[model samples]
Target: MKEKKSMIEEEKEDHLKSTKRIEMEEQLANPDEEPQEVISEKEEY
Candidate 1:
């Protein structure tokens, strides 16, 4: 049970990292746009 819980935790961390990477790529693609993703995430939380 402990191992399964830990796996879930690790997966959550990986998802956050991947989401951040995707946002960064989006910023790169739209260099002229402001970094609004960060602000949006804060609002979501």
Candidate 2:
């Protein structure tokens, strides 16, 4: 039972890591676009 719990925890950690990696990649891919998005949000306000 402990082994199964550990495996589930590891899977959750891996999923979180993967999502962080994806967000990092997106930021890297659109380093300029992010500023534009922020600017648009400010303009809306």
Candidate 3:
């Protein structure tokens, strides 16, 4: 049925969004201790 298919798609989308949120939270919780090295470059017009 069309309704059943739509429900399954919605569930899949919700699961994907949740997983991405969890990954982001984990990264925020444990940040890198080392300072990031940057290479300064002259801006070109």
Every candidate's lDDT: 0.83, 0.79, 0.61
lDDT of predicted model 1: 0.83
> Residue 29 lDDT in model 2?
82
Best by lDDT: 1
Candidate 1: C-alpha RMSD to true structure equals: 3.7
Error of 3 at 13 (Å): 0.3
> In candidate 2, what residue range of length 10 has the lowest lDDT sum?
33-42
Model 2 C-alpha lDDT per residue in residues 1-45, reported as the tens digit of each score: 999999999999999999678667766887876745654775899
Higher-scoring candidate on TM-score, 2 or 3: 2
The pairs that clash in candidate 3 are none
Models 1 onward score TM values of 0.68, 0.66, 0.64
Candidate 1 error regions (>4 Å): 35-45
Please list the residue runs of candidate 2 whose C-alpha ends up more than 4 Å from where it truly belongs after superposition: 33-45
Tell me how candidate 3 scores on lDDT.
0.61
Which lDDT tens digits does candidate 3 get at residues 1-45?
Answer: 999999999999999898677656655664652112111121232
Clashing pairs in 2: none
